[model samples]
Target: MKYAWAAPGAKVVCVVPLGASHDFGIAIDTVMTIAEVDTSPLVKCSVILRFQERPSDCWYAAEAFRPIISQDDDVAMFKAIADRGLAQNGIHVPSSSPEHA
Candidate 1:
């Protein structure tokens, strides 16, 4: 998947660098940032990611990860209804809270 499509809080799975053992499977993590790096002739951009159970950050090539698409129809329908209601009521709210800033 393209690195530009990745967003913070999006779920992704590592597919590259299978490591020493091939028996193990892919690792999943949440995207933190598409980290900026010096341009090079031989290397691609890297992405910063964090596992929910891990405290440290990890970096991997953008090509090494794939975005996870949600398959929950109920959640999608609920979000659509909520959005429609807000729009019909002329309500507006910030996407993020001030505490996050």
Candidate 2:
């Protein structure tokens, strides 16, 4: 999601990753996921980062989309993703996944 906002009174802030479709594989994200510290709520029971395409504003909060993926460590999760992106281009990304993706 390119942008995110709470439900006005919700304490749980979500990490929304804004993305868009590209010529590659299927979806090519132009920018990385954005997590606002001041407005974003702490990691909680229900939190999901959805890919909100451009010109679209439809979004919602989710507890769990499916029976897969545990977002216990969001930083690690996204860091791995970034690492893969960097490795694909022979770039070094600091963190867990230092080697190739």
Strongest candidate by lDDT: 1
Q: What tens-digit string does per-residue lDDT give for candidate 2 at 1-101?
A: 32233222223323343233442211222332212222246645344333333222333334312122337766678877987898999997454444734
Off by over 4 Å in 1: 18-57, 73-101
Error of 1 at 87 (Å): 25
* TM-scores of all candidate predictions against the true structure: 0.37, 0.24
Among all windows of 10 consecutive residues in model 2, the one with the lowest summed lDDT is 25-34
lDDT for model 1, please.
0.53
